[model samples]
Target: MSLKYLKIMEEIKLGLATGSLIAGGKLPSVRRLSQHFSCSKNTVIKAYSELEKEHLIYSVPKSGYYVVAEFQHRTNENEVIDFLSAGPDKNVMPYLEFQHCINQAIEHYKEELFTYSDQQGSYSLRVQLVKHLQNLQVFTQAERLVVVSGSQQALHLLVSMPFPNGKNNILIEQPTYFGFIESLTLHQATAFGIELSMKGIDLDRLEYIFRNNDIKFFYIIPRFHNPLGHCYTNFEKKKIVELAEKYDVYIVEDDFLGDLDPDAKSDPLFSFNPSGRVIYIKSFSKIFLPGLRIAAVVLPSLMNSNFLRYKFSSDFNSSALSQGALEIYLKSGMFTSHLKKIKEVYHTKMQTLVEACDSLLPAHTHFSKPTSGFYLSISLPEHVTAKQIVHMLNEQHIYVDDASRFFLPEYKRDTLLRLSISQVNTNTIKRGIEQLAQCITLIDDRNDDRKNHPIPNNLFLL
Candidate 1:
């Protein structure tokens, strides 16, 4: 076992030497690396420790290790302008204030946090989340809510396990969260995807799927959907709940970004669920601290046992220290204050992205300025693929996510790209979008050139 870990350390060292992995790169977590390399967790830990001692990596408590940025340059030196972040900028996070909360937990909770707390979670965090969920218009008892590492972890638990209610399959929007698809794929669960455009879901198709398939649940991101950045109207939200009730399918609402833009008047699917069909999960990774990996899953009373059983089997429990810190942070009113500050900052960033794309994009390209979320989708000209757009933008030191990742592999790939306003400042947003516009124009210009100057018939001749 020891020698095997030594080999793993050697493999990583070679990567660093060859410059395959660079400074500021994140090493896979111990569990992930263990699974990938088919090694024991302790073996992976030993390997990581070896690298750490060599000054090749360093660990952050709670968070995983990171490759130390080399002053002795090993990788490409090009500065990257990011327009692909799904979370808020680290600088904007209330690090000092959150650290203050962590200190309070250490000072207050004492050695109690060092032990396994609860399979559900720390009681105080659950109490705080009940209040938080109420603000999102999801009134629920603390008993129903389970504190989790993150919303994705909750999703994995929901889809990756058998249900007592006999939910044999899952349904999602045609362009839903990629993580949902990932979970479904990992569990080999049958997934039926219905088309969901900016106009909202195709109700007829959704009903058809529900009527035909034994859909265990409908996994949805109703507010600020990933990649699409479109939220469901109250009418649409109500309509979905009605369909679920009609077809007897559970609804798993992932409101990961719900805390970012809150409208007291608006309600989630959980709010309209009177029959206990909706399982709502709220992720604080975006609004609060991503490193903490804190989220809450509000499950139906029926699912509590099954969910808890799987959760306990998985990791037993989430980190007690992270939950304690968050409970205190939420209680201190700092979470609300941080949200307000980020909203104002991101509002300007979003507006800047809108102006840049609208004013500079090539003719025939189309995009919608999102009203609430951080992402905006761009529909490139039919002739230009997302790959071509991403490649060109990458050359200009700008990075964006291709919309193809949001779709199932068997489905036809769309000529689309997704831009997020979370990471970049107004200046970087402007510069990145301007470069993106140039790529769009260049692609069209090349296509026009190909049209005007037809290829010779013998061009492919040997």
Candidate 2:
């Protein structure tokens, strides 16, 4: 191959690495890219054609070329660690026990698993969930439970379910879970966001949203919320339950990380509202494996008919095989045992991350110590942008969720970054933190320079 061809191939590789061409992402047309790069169409064609032949890219007749899959290459320890992306700490996952349970479920329940299970989910899993919720002090019955594929699906179904037309508004925390926002958007529901604080949802803002809008439902993650690892206090939970009662608004409490708490004794919002006004949704993915895609929503007795209808319409049911396996896993006492192990692992990882941040990060940068769950949000200086920080981290092969993405368009705050400890090991955690510190310091330095040497009017013209 000529040097020109080699350079084109290098550019393709770099594009994939930098996510200029993401997985399942379509590449620009050869002619378009050729013109942009000021290169011949044949050169662009040669590179793409070569990649296609190698099965790295695939093309459709009318559609364009797309990256099919990532090619894994062997590398050293640091390179391997870099490849592992500085996101959640995967080392804490209970892979062995989970795999064992899955294998056993498949082997023993092959025939039953192949068929469609109940729309409400496997009876046994529902029973298990009832027990799990009771253990968490949120009392509920099996009849009140419905299983969805994941928390995302649960949110989708909840948002889509018909409510009184006049009371169609939904209340969500500003900068809350992105999936919840997407769900509300898809359902075409009007959602008003309540501002959040370190103490959890701002009660004043909650009341304001409720009083100002005809909110039929309120969605909240009262325990270790995504983007912000703020857990609701027992007092706050009681106050929230009171507000819901006062307004006659159903609170959709996403207790996605309820089981993963290190304390294991924190009270959920649902515990306060036993009258079925509060719908509690929980996920098994973060604590277990993401592929499990198992989530349960505890519905009020009155909503049972609506929920059943919704579940029937939405994919008919959750995965029967996975539900069956989870049921067996729960019955065998393996689930709890594995959870206990994960708690210890995650607790230790959280501590390590906190320690690393304390030592490496600037004192001005602040973060809350997460009591449970896989993530915590770090607050940067006011002038710093989360997007810029994420970009800097990505250049070093580290990935993090920008906190701005979690907020509504009107609530764009640039000073926070959500760091997840679910996909990295202890060693990688240390390294990732060091790199993050470096990135932040670099940004701070640049800001200082800009402040000291303001841009001239002539530069603005360019």
Which candidate leads in TM-score? 1
How would you encode candidate 1's per-residue C-alpha lDDT over 1-462 as one tens digit per residue? 656786677677656644566778888889998888888999999888866866778999999988888512332336567787777764466655677799999999988787898989998889998997887888988898899888989999888876655769888887877887888898888888887776778888888989999999999998878888878889889989999899888899999888666455778999898447888999888776778887899888888888998989888999999988888998999887878877777666777777887788876888866666678888889788899988887886778989887887765466878888787645466667777888888888899999999999898894
Weakest lDDT window of 10 consecutive positions for candidate 1? 70-79
Q: Which residue segments of model 2 deviate by more than 4 Å? A: 1-110, 164-166, 458-462
User: Per-candidate RMSD vs. true structure?
Assistant: 12.1, 13.4
Off by over 4 Å in 1: 1-79, 412-414
- Whole-model Cα lDDT of every candidate shown, in order: 0.81, 0.77
Model 1 clash pairs? 149-293
Residue 228 miss distance in model 1 (angstroms): 1.1
Q: Per-residue error at 175 for model 2, in Å? A: 0.8
Please give the TM-score that candidate 1 achieves against the real structure: 0.81
Task: Quote the lDDT for 406 in model 1.
Answer: 84
> Per-residue lDDT of 172-201 in model 2, one digit per residue for the tens?
888798888887777777888888856566
